[model samples]
Target: MRKASIRLKTALLASLTCVTVHAWGMSFERQERCIEGLTPKCQVMILATGQIDKDSPKQFKSFAQTFPRGTWVAVSSPGGNLVGGMQLGLAIRELGFNTTIGNSDYSPPDCLSACAYAFAGGVSRKLTPGSRYGLHQFRGSDQAINAEDTQKISATLAKYLDAMGVDRRLLDYAQMTTSDKVTVLTLAQAQLLKVDTAGQTSYARWKVEVTPDSKLLAINSSLFTVGSQIPITLGILPVPGQNNKVACLIYYKSNDASAFSASNPQHFEIGKEIYPLISAGNWQEKTGGYQATFLIPDNLLIALLQAPDDTVITLSGSFSKPPQSNTTTASTNPLTAYFGVGNLKNSLQALLKR
Candidate 1:
């Protein structure tokens, strides 16, 4: 709808409809690597490289079945089949996987045109340093397509981007360039458009609210998990009728129905200290996922408040089980979601003044 010149090529549409033998499509390969972190552990990584076609999403789902949910998917593609690329992105997002623009060897690679759509699907998208994320106008195979059809395709693409938390302005950037050329975005621009989210741990800032009792105070912030960016709200509220006393809790809500399990071990980590969290015994099952709460120890809550503003607090839990394999010992690698204590002290001080 933006412009009559912006159109999808019938060739790409044919790729999705016809049952013809194309040269080659996307390939999904699995590899195991020792991930270095608080605990050095062996993790399975998926490498998706090649042209994204109609079959790519299916291929990815099949290949990803054996790996854990937070597994990394490194993609390197020149782009193909726009609809197929969006479908592949949806699959990635559905599985709660992380995406990056790279190859199996971890070399920076180009994720251009339609491939960018698939990249957008990542829960945590990272553009490798030196990697190129380019977009351009869609091209067809010399088939005449009407304006109405093109507008529909554009609208669908816009909706997909919005669902993925990407800026719709990305489409404007794509339309600005012709299909024959690519418009590669700089790191700053990519971050501005939310195509990349490296080092972005918190989704929401600290918000202070008055409890229903009026005398008690509640402060909450939304922190995201490391790989998938699963939102976990950290809430600190005064204990009822306990003067200068507060209780802490973490609330996890996800659209993925299986996102959290009561049996899984969950904890909060600050520096060398590990504080275990127990289920608050409150659970609500929603349409697609569940919402649950975990209670934080009073000591941990005090530590969090006293800690430096730049201190990073991790919310870890065994969210997924490892695949059964002889080469790798099956272990529950806890999800390492963390957030910095940015201006929390100031917010608390301001709240007290209020």
Candidate 2:
């Protein structure tokens, strides 16, 4: 029986391995559109976890040619092709295309490794409900990369992420640490990382009730949780509609707390306030409720450890300035009418319970 069980486990793992390497297990409609004969649209629906190698070079080359004007290459990959994936990530910078992670159809979350790379490249990035981005340690079959190589990889990735406009701090999370491999970013973390976070808009995103007069002032988060990552979901009242576009400043709290002094604080932008900084990515229920996860940078974790239990999660919001000439005042989203921080949690708890 033990032998049989081992065989079963190995079989399952092998099956999953195959799925992970190739961009299989997805149901998507390929949309054919080109811009300036360079970038092309590769829209996809992520119904299951898998990799993407199909026409990757074509997609990469196209984006490199047409991306400066915001051409998008849609994708639905659980993530695969690390080297190719990294190359694709680099292409986003070279091609200059705004990336997209959701297909027109309702799809499962894009997750793990390579998919996360592509998701991060969204010019106007997004992490809708079903949308997900995952991370893991760098690994291979025979030989292993040394520490120096990993550092080189980190530096290269830093450049890639910088080009994507991700929080500079997130680069630390993107680095590979353990060979075991397993880093998934929940929706809450996605918000903290300032990945374009939209609830249920693109696929399976958190749904915020907004009214005709609703307006979200800003979004914020605490520092990334140490030891283990904590999921966080920052709120934005007037989320982008069908387009799923969002832009804002994401303050990455350094793991080194000394850099942030209370008397002469430099953490907050404009020195307005301070808070913890959590990683960002799409978070959904593994079984029930939301599950957010991201690598906790050592520095942010250190700061959080010293923080008090009641430490308010400092944050900020940047509402796009209204039309300069509009005479009308504004209203708020009824769904976002909560009074306190706990209120949002309570509401989410209630939502999860339901």
Candidate 3:
């Protein structure tokens, strides 16, 4: 029985290796059309079902040349040929085209390993909803690269990322993921690195819901709990002067000192007024503006959202004038909202029970 089991294990290992080796080659089918309903000015090129190869650059350049400048190239690949991938990426960058991970049908797709290199070359990159970008350490057929050559590759990649305006920290993330296992970037990670550069309009059309007000606050979820954090993304108009700061103030009347004690900063001050920053520990600065996660428990949040109508949250700071003449009255306040007492009470009551 032991001898039979050993033979089965060896056979299965050989079969798995064969499958992996077969996936390490490249082929592609290119489709030219406006994908994702983009305009003709932004023609879309699709690279689906293939690995990158020595001729990949030539193939990409040929199609890219036919399109006007600033086209979008949608890529979906299992990854192949590291050298070829980099070359193809350089060519795409040279042509000044944007890149996304998607299919000709506008379906989401994966850009993994070698494919990630080419995707990074975009003048403006995007990863559509349901799409993913994955990475892993560099590798060769023998599963090892010389130290000197590896250093050169690292330097070259750093240079490319710098030129492409991508965050260098991405290299750290890539290296952290071993070659045999893929590291798929989370939505937050992709956005933080500017890998998804789809415009504000595109994003607004997606999952974001903007308040119909002079000051807008976009909350990812209306539901909240003490156990986890919820992100509230604020869109602040550019300030009048450089380096101007905005402070978000949260006010609540609490009898429970324990809840209040848990906050990062016990107090927040702006001029003469002071209030505790809610869930201060969860606050962070993001690419465009500031985001804060509400760390207060359901009951505390309910209290803040209700009673003492005077208790309120506000954003106060100097902000740049909106460019549009019609929107000149855009609020410098950025965020000001009053939660409905009855509705919030019910929501919190149900949430805490769960």
TM-score of each: 0.55, 0.39, 0.47
Task: Mark the 10 consecutive residues where model 2 has the least summed lDDT.
Answer: 331-340
Order of all candidates by lDDT, from best down to worst? Answer: 1, 3, 2
How far does residue 256 in candidate 1 sit from its true spot (Å)? Answer: 14
Q: Give one digit per residue, the lDDT tens place, for model 3 in 58-103.
A: 7777655666545677787767766566667666655556787765
Residue-level lDDT for 76 in candidate 2 = 62
Candidate 1 regions with alpha-carbon error over 4 angstroms: 1-23, 31-45, 65-72, 90-97, 103-108, 123-126, 138-165, 178-181, 201-237, 243-296, 299-354
Model 2 C-alpha lDDT per residue in residues 199-280, reported as the tens digit of each score:
1111112234543566432333331211111212344322245222222223322222322222221121112234333434
lDDT of each: 0.63, 0.39, 0.48
Q: Report the C-alpha lDDT of model 1 over 1-354, residue by residue, as the tens digit.
A: 111111234343543321111335788887764433302245667878877787898888887876765577878887887777877887786566767776655334888888899998776777776789998877554564467756766776786676676888999988788777789999899999989865442223466666566643445433224333344566665555544444455554444433344455678788889988767664466443355555556687578669874466667767655211111223235656555576666555543343
Off by more than 4 A, model 3 = 1-21, 24-44, 104-108, 200-354
- Higher-scoring candidate on lDDT, 1 or 2: 1
Best by lDDT: 1
lDDT, candidate 3, equals 0.48
